[model samples]
Target: MVTERDKELIGALQKGLPLVRRPYAALGERVGMGEQEVLRRLADLRAKGVIRRHGVIVRHHELGYRANAMSVWAIPDERIDDLGEQLAGEPGVTLCYRRRTAPPAWPYNLYCMIHGQDREAVLARRRELAEKYGLDQWAHRVLFSGRRFKQRGAWYRPPQPAPEKAEVRHG
Candidate 1:
């Protein structure tokens, strides 16, 4: 069960940690908790499965990776697990995962993202990966992103209150 204080801590987390040498200390100050207390509470939350995991959203363009391509494949269901794992471990592959396919429209199920400084490099890397992993045997497509959307971590919202019980009067 989340206490009121935990909610306060979560609120601070939703704002994103402040960029400082002692970020946890700063975060604790905001939540009216000490650094160690904050850490302990976070650890407890993780142990209890209240918090799943943490991740970073990188700005690839700013980091000189201008070309971004999402290479999707229609791998056979039986072979998808092995191939997805192999492709995910390849160099230049930033992200990889499986998704549900919409047949007759979109048949791609397995997806991997690769970023590079230019389109040629990204495409070449994709081709190499496909040939090296025998991914060319499967139908696939490389879709280059034309624009980037804003990215941020997950947001937490407060739970709504239950409705008050209605009292019925009897004559």
Candidate 2:
């Protein structure tokens, strides 16, 4: 079970650090903690793998990356590791990993995220990758995100009962 402090720390991390010279300190002030304590708790959470990484989540489109696609590749099961590493090392390829292929309807195992300023640029890069890696034989598709519904850090709060005052009193 997470302690109350832990819950607060999770909330803070989920919301994100404030844009300031001493952002943690500002967050700590809001939650009745000091900057050092906040840092300590963050370190502890990361060490335990509760937090994978602490970094900014940028708006790619706002930053002029109008085209972003999830590119899936059908790589041989035996060569996934080597090919995944190679794909990840490529410029503008932000993410790459392997997933179990879905039958009949979906048949891609390897996935990578590619971002560019426009559809043509992204497609051009994909073609370049296809040629460089001899991926023409492998089936692939680029699925662009139609809309962004939720793109925030994980919320780690547990359910709570109604506030005692609200439960007990009537105006």
lDDT of 1 by residue, 37-134 (tens): 99888888788878765445456689899998999999999999999989878999988989888997999998889989999999999999998989
lDDT of 2: 0.76
Span of 10 residues, lowest total lDDT, candidate 1: 162-171
User: How well does candidate 1 score on lDDT at residue 32?
Assistant: 83
How much RMSD separates candidate 1 from the native structure?
A: 10.1
What are the lDDT scores of the predictions, listed in order?
0.80, 0.76
Error of 2 at 142 (Å): 2.7
Candidate with maximal lDDT: 1
Over 4 Å off in model 1, which ranges?
Answer: 1-4, 46-56, 149-154, 159-171
Q: Which residue pairs show collisions in model 2? A: none
